[model samples]
Target chain A: MTRVYLDNNATTIVDPKVYDVMSPFFCQMYGNPNSLHSFGSETHPALRTAMNQLYKGLNASDDDDIIVTSCATESNNWVLKAVYFDKILNGDKNHIIISEVEHPAIYSTCKWLETLGVKVTYLPVNHDGIVEAHTVKDFITDKTALVSIMWANNETGAIFPIKEIAQICKEKNVLFHTDGVQAVGKIKVDVQDVEVDFLSFSAHKFHGPKGVGGLYIKNSQELSALLHGGEHMGGRRSGTLNVAGIVGMGLAMELANDAIEYENKEVRRLRDKLEDALLQIPKTFVVTSRDKRTPNTMLISIKGVEGEAMLWDLNKAGIAASTGSACASEDLEANPVLMAVGADKELAHTAIRLSLSRFTTEDEIDYTIDVFKKAVIRLREISGSYAE
Target chain B: MAKNDLIGGSIWEEYSNKVAELMNNPKHRGRFTQEEADSKGFKLIVADFGAESCGDAVRLYWLVNPNGDIIENAKYESFGCGTAIASSDMMVELCIGKSVDEAVKITNLDVEMALRDSPDIPAVPPQKMHCSVMAYDVIKKAASLYKGVDMASFEQEIIVCECARVSLSTIKEVIRLNDLKTVEDITNYTKAGAFCKSCIKPGGHEDREYYLVDILRETREEMEKDKLLQNANTVFGGGTVAFNDMTIVQKIKAIESIIDENIRPMLVMDGGNIEILDVKDSGSHTDVYIRYLGACSGCASSSTGTLFAIENVLKAKLDNALRVFPV
Candidate 1:
């Protein structure tokens, strides 16, 4: 069967150009970038190019710090735990605020922090899966250490008002952190423009290698280090660096930024076509409309069919999709994103997220339309939920 | 190569082939209309059951030969995950050609076994096991509709832990067979309170009338009491003595175990607890003397409801003459 890949929000396929650039770093120029020997000094020019590529990709100022880590999870954990060390322990500010629809890295971290005398306030989202700035304003106080929210939701793809919330955090003299795992390559992200203190991103979410990620810190802020060792990344994050992964991720960011127009034009067009054809099915509703969400994501729910069963049907047809974040798929709980958006429990189980990429073709979208419709129709008839 | 290799291979590997096959091509997934049943000259029975844990529901259809009280055909409509669809298909397959009374004997265990690729392997993961349990529940709903009996009539056994389908008898039998000591031993042997842990102790996700802590204490007491009776009988000749004939040592042991297992946990939750000082068998009654600890001693209502609860547990478990007095 000719497979159609649609679950890009979970992870994207590594670009061939990135693979080509990384292959030489493994055997030919394999040396520790931190070593003083010439064998290591030979990799300096490439490492410098890679680091500069990341800085230009996210449009971070040269004076800011972009410490590379293993993945976005590591970056997110560093931001939350570092803020806990900096402001919560030494000062009277024991409070932190975050959105209810954050990824598990942010959500579960905040939950774990509550056990250590940290007061966490989970800000609820509206029916469209949006967290407003005024709501954050209502919760902020002198004792609040940080306001951490996501730039875009992985499940619903609903983009938040990061700029406005960053402004509020600045006025309240609180640090702002945005998880940019889903937003970096899928939409426009400029660290200088948004003015967020910290932004965490992963490489694999935007056609990069799996093992490398970066955290952008504005103006070299005084956040505590998560890993204390050798002076790698200016003593912020330590340990030996993954040289090949860093090189591939840097080039991948450059390529993804170069393809932003193609993502907005071609990828969005294909996603809209798939969404329109699916909406023709009975009892289907999108979680957030196209204008409010990222251009490449469509989170739809069919009335009486469960999400995992839909994935099974799509899997049989060689089509890939997701119920929500792939990390939470093993869990049998209802989709928390949909529940936070005021959806009933029944509707929460029916959420299916279909994300597109720049590599998605028109033929694949048409084939998905046919397979998804047939699967939903057959399952509905079996469930006796077909209105007709 | 699996098609789900795009991200990872966790969920695709969790489902068995039978689940994937039936989820895509469910052969017995439809409802029989009344007209179709009338044309076949068979009685039509429709039954619906919904799982409150997940939003899954299943409606069972049985075409019964009323003369013989046999089901000629069976079909189902399952609204759940892939596991539920396959489990329902397997459930309906087992129902065909069985008599109404015999079909009611079908259990969730039987449904899950029928859906398995092999006898030794499970059809679904532990989380999705509730779907097959739902499949079994819908069968009982259909049987009740066929015989015009209440659905609760088939549920005679007490369910101690609903998550793993471990009944009260099953738990007691496992404990006795293994001579289990702690609640952890009972969990490993019977898998009763592992899933949600609500069935393990006093307060958890939901309120339960039966708990593993109390059951373990009760069964251990019975075992010890049986041993003590055997020893006493051996010292004399072969004879039997009922509850009232039990010695004061045996009586005190029972009262203390009951107090710690059933009563103390509740009191400890309120930052208060009770300590049993002694058990005195008076001429007219047996009295259990206890001292209140922490805030329970200063509270006025502890003498009334608190005393009644302790006495109620002791009397129900040991002897009717037992009374609790907080000194």
Candidate 2:
């Protein structure tokens, strides 16, 4: 059975270059990165080179700090908790600003702060899932601690004006954080141009091993440590380093940055074709922002069928897709993002998210389109009088 | 994207065509109406007896002469469903030459037996019995008005199927409809005791050997009790609670009536509508079912709406019961 995997936004296949670079560290150089021994020293050079790759990709100054963590979720949690608590206790700021559609890692954590007496003002996103620059500026008050937004929506791939939002935040003297997990490798995201105080990235989203991601801290304001422990990420987070994962992630970032422009064109073309072919099927509609989108993502709603049923049919035909955010699938709630876009319950439940990768072939896209079309026909026949 | 690619044949088009055809059919989904009636005695100068309960088992109106003979013609009117209306028409046809006592003895069982050969009138619930009893009341009333006759001392009251709220008068009217032959026939045609088996006989037979007079007296007592309960339900306002089907007061009246009328007669007839199942509360709902007896087991639609109706009425009356499911 030939499976055409398209849910890259959930997680991508590991790159061979990343694998090759990290392979030796698993055995010959198994020493902890925190250790001062020769084995550890051997791994440090690779880690430095990986950081250099990120620095160039982000256009960061030589002194900009990069602290690694498990994944983008952890990076987000660390920023929200660290920044909010630090300002509340030390900087005397109690109000926080965030976009309405920030990923749960940022939005949910900030919501939790309300119980602790911290007031959060969530800036609204336009129908396209983009928060206006002025909206962020208006939300920033004298007591505002931070403003957090997303670089690109994971479900719709709608990119926000992060640089403009960040510049406005800078002018207002409020901290800015951007969850760049969807934008990092898929788009040319230069954090220096955006000038955000913090940006989150995960390795697994761009063809590296999971359980390894980082936050870019660009300013001189010291962040409170998320973990209390001995020498690891300069005591910022505890536990011995996931040496192999970190090495693979460093290698993945370098490779993603080097060929990003060409890869962007290839995936965007494939993505557009898939979207067009899918919409050609009866009763299918694209749910993402069309003119501006992440090069590799397409979310569509198929009328008269449940998304889970369609997923099962597609899975049988060896095509991988998602209903919405992968995290929301655990409880089987309708996608909140689709709901925010004013989709009715039926449309929200019927949405299928197909995310392409740099290596996805045109042939696979065509095969998926054929399978998708057939599945919709078969499902409608089974449903009988239940029409959407 | 191109609009040309979006055009195609789909199942929705097929459904639209089917709907057009369905609209032309006579039995096409729509509302239908029916009228029903049940009354008491007949006329002439021959044979008269105590027929207070007879009218409830048969549905028709009758007039009697000074000497107890049935009068050839009598005026009749009824307000009920289609079968009940047809049952009233059938009663007039069946009793033109019968004596007043003979007409009084006639049950819904006899009317349906006559209707077996009549193709125009569909067999219905034994509401004819109640109509027959009502006919007897009118005849007695008219006789009293004309000749100053007093017969209150001879009157008897009875209750039959409790779940259906059937009384001796009610049963006589049902019998006048001429559809029900046995207790189970009542269950099938009228939805009586189908939910809880309070009226049905135990072993699938009508148990006709039981004395009708004793059952009638017992039912009278039960009716009095149910009247009280019904009044209580009215006072409390018959609203089903969030987790219950019938209100507490409604359930009380229903259960009381069922036990006194439906269950007692079946027991006397050497059969019974036995309690078989009780469903624990599920979520905010509850359900229950009872065993059918006499002829009720063979009833087709009794298993559907009739069953639910009994359960629902009881649940509403017994507000705490939640919901009822048949087993």
Candidate 3:
């Protein structure tokens, strides 16, 4: 069976080159990046090289800083919590703003902070999932501490106006953080270009290891450390670094960057063709913003069947897809993001996310279309949700 | 491979056949026709919690000989699972010679206890116990009908499972399905509201509505005692926990064991847990671990419900620490 993986927004296959670069670090080059001995010192160069590669990949100049963390989740929590914690202690800022469609890693953390007496303002997004610059401007108060938004939605692949939002934050002298986990490899992300104060990315989102990620804090800013332990990442992040994971992430990033042009063009073409073919099926609705979306993502909501049931049927037919946010797939609760954009509860349940990658092929798409067409037809018959 | 082979060649085949035999015996299964019940003096009742998936109901047949001569040799039919069908088989064996009135006294608790002899039923006692209660209620109803009394007239005295608060009519309506032998089977047929906990068998606990016998007196007393909150208009079913209901705690614990030992570890591998906290006796929490034993621990969707379920249950039963964990 030629398995078609169309859930790249959830995770991706680790590139073989990334694996080759990481193999030595796992065994022969196994040493704590924090250690001072020759054994550790040998691995230190590789770790530094990885960090430097990432720094360059994101267009960070000599004055920029990068902090290595465990994953995008840790980076998000660290950045959001650190800002709030620093503001509280420094007696300078207290308010935090975020888009309603931010990932749970950011939204949930900010929501969690509200329980601690921190004030947070959730700015709503338009139907296209773009946060208006005015909403950002309106929400920023003198007490505003930070504005965190995701660069690209993991579900709809809708691109938020990060550059505009970042500009507003800069004008107001507020720290800007963008969860670039979904945007980094699929789309070009230059933190300097966007003027983002902090940017977070995970390796596994782009064919690197799962447990490793990166946090970029512009070198000019003096940020507080998130984890307290043996000094690593220049005392910005603590604990021994995941040398193998870091190295893999660096290689993955470099490869992803090199393949961006070709993959983007190819994936977008295939994605559009698949979307058009799928939409030709009766009562199917496209979920991604037509003009502005990640090249690799296409979300569809079949009118009459549950997204989950269809996913299972497709899985049996060798085409893997997802419904709504991966975090809330089995919730039975409709997608809050879909709801935020005014999607009906039933439509939210019917929504299916089909994210592609450079590896996705034409035959795979054709097979998926065939499999999905049958699954949806069968599910529709059993679903008994047809309108009169 | 060897393990599956062992089960396939030995235990699995026998278990499947036994379940099949019980399930296939339709002459003895389903709602007993009026003539059949009069002849055999028994009926099969299956209550399904439809809102929940799989088994969440009390499904076992009853031997209702209203005149008190239980049919000692009556056969049963079940199409659900080994435990449910076996429970039906066991119910017939336990109550056959006993009178219908005597059978009315039988509970799902009894059927689950009877199931202790059979290991293939997955041994979820709370749900099995519910099955027992459902069987008891059906037999009692059938016995009342045989005696020219309307069982529906006494709604207050007939408590289904105290934890579930399912009514006799609810059970009757739920169990009217044809091919139910397991709680999960009932769920498929009826869609009973078993969201918060297991609805597999009917024995766990009953969530009874509080209706004062002396309404005026109780009202005056409540007003005099200034305990107005106790008499608030909460829904009359299985949502709230009763302070005096000790069995509910046991049921919750049993559910915890099933989730922890059978369902949770898989969710944990995906980083989730159905946790309970603030277990109020000492203001401490109990961290139960359900080590996923099958191919499910690594499944992605398992963790989706793991934390929320634990938190929801704990929030209902306990007071704190119902937050998400790193699992």
Candidate 4:
């Protein structure tokens, strides 16, 4: 059976072109970029080229503006911790403002910092999972060190008003960081246009190899390093550079930049069809705002049925999807993102996220709609909560 | 489907094939009606159990023979995740054809073991083990309803780990049977302290009546005592000394003399010395209070690593129940 994978928000398959560009670096062109030799010289230029590509892709001011890291989790952690520690060293700021629906990389780090006497304010989202700019403005004070929010939510796919929030931070003279992991490839993200002090994104979310990601820091901003070792990546991030992974990420971003227009048009059309067909089922409704969310994502709740049971049925039918954030699925906790939007416990528990990608075909979307409708019907029948 | 294609590859593979089969197509899943019970000439008993943490609930039904203790039929309806449905189905299957008395004897372990594809492997992940426990608790509820007795009376032992539904006897048995060394080992074997971790020790996210740490310590002490008693004639100098018979002053003098003769030289060579403060005797146990002087007073190991070393010598020389505490 052909598998219809719709969990793109979790991770995407590496593009074959990206893989082809990365292959030569694995064995043939492999060298320590830091080592001073012919082999090192050959690899060092390749690293610079990949860095330049990412720099142009993000519309960064220069190559130094991009700091490549292992994953978005690391990049997010680096930004949060670097800002917190820098303020601590200078004895200037103590407070941080972040949205409640942030990925665990930001939320969990903030929570841990709170235990260490750092004051953190979690801004709540509206019914549509959008964090209003005024809510962020109200929380900003002179003591606030940074305002970190994600550009797009992984679970709900709701696009936050990052530009407006950045403007508020600029007016307040406070640093702003956005986890642009979901938005960078799917949407046209220009760092200069948004004017965010820092931004983070991973490669795997946009058809690149896993384990390679980048963080964008605006020029003239100074932040401490998370990992300190031999001088590498311009002393901003220190470790051995993943040359092949970096090449894959650079090529992936180039391809994503080329296909963004096509993805927005075709993917959105297919996603809307899937959403409309699924809503035809009784007691089903889209959870996220239709206008403010990513074009390739839809979060829907089928009442009286558990998401895990439904996903299991979908899996049996060769359709892959997710209940909420893949990271929090093991604990089986109700999605906090849905709850932040004022969804009741049952609604939160019943939410299923289906995210598409550039590769998602029209046939795949129709099959998913058919299989998902049947799964919901069968699950509701067995759930003992549905009336005949 | 290929095993790797599942939700989480290796982690989901921990679930037995039977559990997956039963989750997809559960047997005895619907409600057992009163009409069916009347047709079979059996009395029906219904019991409900719910987990407050996850909001998962299970309702069990038993049709018992009116003339005897045999269960004519068993069925269940679970209002939770796939694991709960699978567990309830297995629970009902295990109850059928068994006498009511025998049905009560089937434990959560039996329900879990029946779902295991192999004897050594666990049927489900540690977090999902509670579902089987929910199945086990409902059987007791049904049996109590049928027998006209309180559900609490059916519990033969106290439960130490509520998340894993591990009884004190089972914990002790696992500890003794495997010669388990630590609380982590208990979790590895029985999944006792795996989830929520309130059962591992005090000051966790939740509160519990008994803790796995306390159980392991007490069980280890009991096992130690048994070992000491088993070799009572061979251990120590000639035979074990009854330190309980001595007065507090005598116990202090005995400990100080041993320290002076054997332990003091070793400490002095390391630029440290030990001094006895007091000795107190509690029933079945003795507490020796001591103070460290010189380098040992400020040393990090003096409180823990060295204290254990001191306690070991005291246990070997004194009584098995003697506990040494730094003053």
The candidate that achieves the highest lDDT relative to the unseen native structure:
1
Candidate 4 predicts chain B with a TM-score of 0.59
- Model 3 residue B228 CA deviation (Å) reads 14
Q: What DockQ do you compute for every candidate structure?
A: 0.20, 0.01, 0.02, 0.13
After superposition, the stretches of candidate 1 with alpha carbons farther than 4 Å from their true spots are A325-331, B1-9, B51-53, B161-164, B172-184, B193-327
Second chain TM-score, each model: 0.60, 0.28, 0.34, 0.59
**Tens digits of per-residue lDDT for model 2, B1-327:** 168438642211222221212111211111112211113332322213222111111112334544556545543332221222233334445555665555545455454445343444323223222322332443344444434456452235454542243555665445446534465555555565443343454322122222233343455556657655666665446433332344444444456564455444544364434454444545654544466665555566457865665665655545554454445
**Model 2 over residues A306-371: C-alpha lDDT tens digits?**
565566568767898877522112123446666667765545556788999988998899899898
Over the stretch A1-388, how does candidate 3's per-residue lDDT look in tens digits?
Answer: 7799999998999999899989997769887766678878899777778877888778887788877789999999998888877875576787889887788899899889999878889888787766778899998999998999889988889888899999999999888999999998888899878889999999999989899998888865866777988767777788887889999998898888887897679988999989989998988877647677999987787766655456656766678788762211113345656667776654655778999998899999998888888877655543334432
Give a tens-digit lDDT track for model 3, residues B47-79.
Answer: 222111222122233444434455443443322
* Candidate 4 runs further than 4 Å off: A44-49, A325-332, B1-9, B51-55, B147-149, B162-165, B168-191, B194-198, B201-327
Docking class of 2: incorrect
Error of 4 at B133 (Å): 1.1
- Best candidate according to DockQ: 1
Worst 10 contiguous positions by lDDT, candidate 4 chain A: A325-334
Number of the candidate with higher DockQ, 3 or 4: 4
Candidate 1 lDDT for residue A124: 91
Over B225-313, each residue of candidate 1 has an lDDT whose tens digit, in order, gives: 88777856643443434547767876676667677789889999989988888888789798888899998998777988888887898
Instruction: Provide C-alpha RMSD values for all models, in order.
Output: 11.4, 27.1, 22.4, 9.6
- Select the stronger candidate by TM-score from 2 and 3: 3
